[model samples]
Target: MSAETRVVLRRAAASDAAAAADVWLRSFAAALPTVVRPRSDDEVRDHIRDVVVPLRETWVAEVADRGGMGGIVGLMVLDGDLLSQLYLAPEWRGRGIGDRFVALAKRRSPRGLTLWTFQVNKPAHRFYERHGFVAVEFTDGSANEEREPDVRYVWQP
Candidate 1:
């Protein structure tokens, strides 16, 4: 499958902080009910705001028109040789946004990259697989509220 919808990706600014936080919370929380279902929305949002949001520089994906709310449809956080928080909105899944995010992360992180995904998130597993990432380790679970097993993925350029 390919991305039929067009999107624009760019570096995020400090002004995007709050909205980006909301984007991560909304998107991940939505996914939670399905995989490793979180105990509460507040906990999920707390993880986003406290952990994921402040951890990395984020890239935002917006509709090509450049108008409307154009909230962050996708995001990426690169920390040295790691690619963290590479999430695309559910509606944007299966489109090329994720591939683009991965490509950008790889380009920005030529030393190699790694990421952690919920063990049961098959879609993400398959997506990472297609991007040439291999499972490197599996943890019993995150210390975070989800309490789900996590799989680590690594890609070497």
Candidate 2:
């Protein structure tokens, strides 16, 4: 997993919905095993297909090798000034895919960006912080669907 390996980041299509949802599921389970998911696998895929991909600025990251876009290694969703979601396949975690995605997010939303992450997701907190995001708010497990304590981070640049 060299940082130099090329990654093709492009808008997700309807066909990518299931794969993107798969990345989300794997990343969620790997990053926050204790957190309970409110939706089933099928429901998640359906939501990604119906709502996230079509209605939001969703991007899928794929490895580009031999002139073809390979399997999807990560996915991100951007909603206006909010970086609604950014998830990477478990094995792709520390290989710069997330950094590139965050860079793209910042480029897309130059004004600023805000995102929420579970409080227990320390790796995510550190990753966002390294990308210039600062913790601006924290909330108990009441506001989010996960019912897990969360922290809000904002990047102003």
Lowest lDDT block of 10, candidate 1: 63-72
For all predicted structures, in order, the TM-scores are: 0.79, 0.94
Q: Give lDDT tens digits, candidate 2, residues 1-157.
A: 6544677899998999888999999989888999999999899989999999999999999887764547888999999999999999998888888888999999999999999999999988999999999999999979999899999999999
Q: Model 2 clash pairs? A: none
Q: How many pairs of residues collide in each model?
A: 0, 0
Question: Global CA lDDT of candidate 1, please?
Answer: 0.74
Query: What root-mean-square deviation over C-alphas does model 1 reach?
Result: 3.4
What are the lDDT scores of the predictions, listed in order? 0.74, 0.91
**Residue 74: error of model 1 in Å?**
1.1
Model 2 deviation from the true structure expressed as Cα RMSD, one decimal place: 1.7
The per-prediction CA RMSD against the true structure, in angstroms, equals: 3.4, 1.7
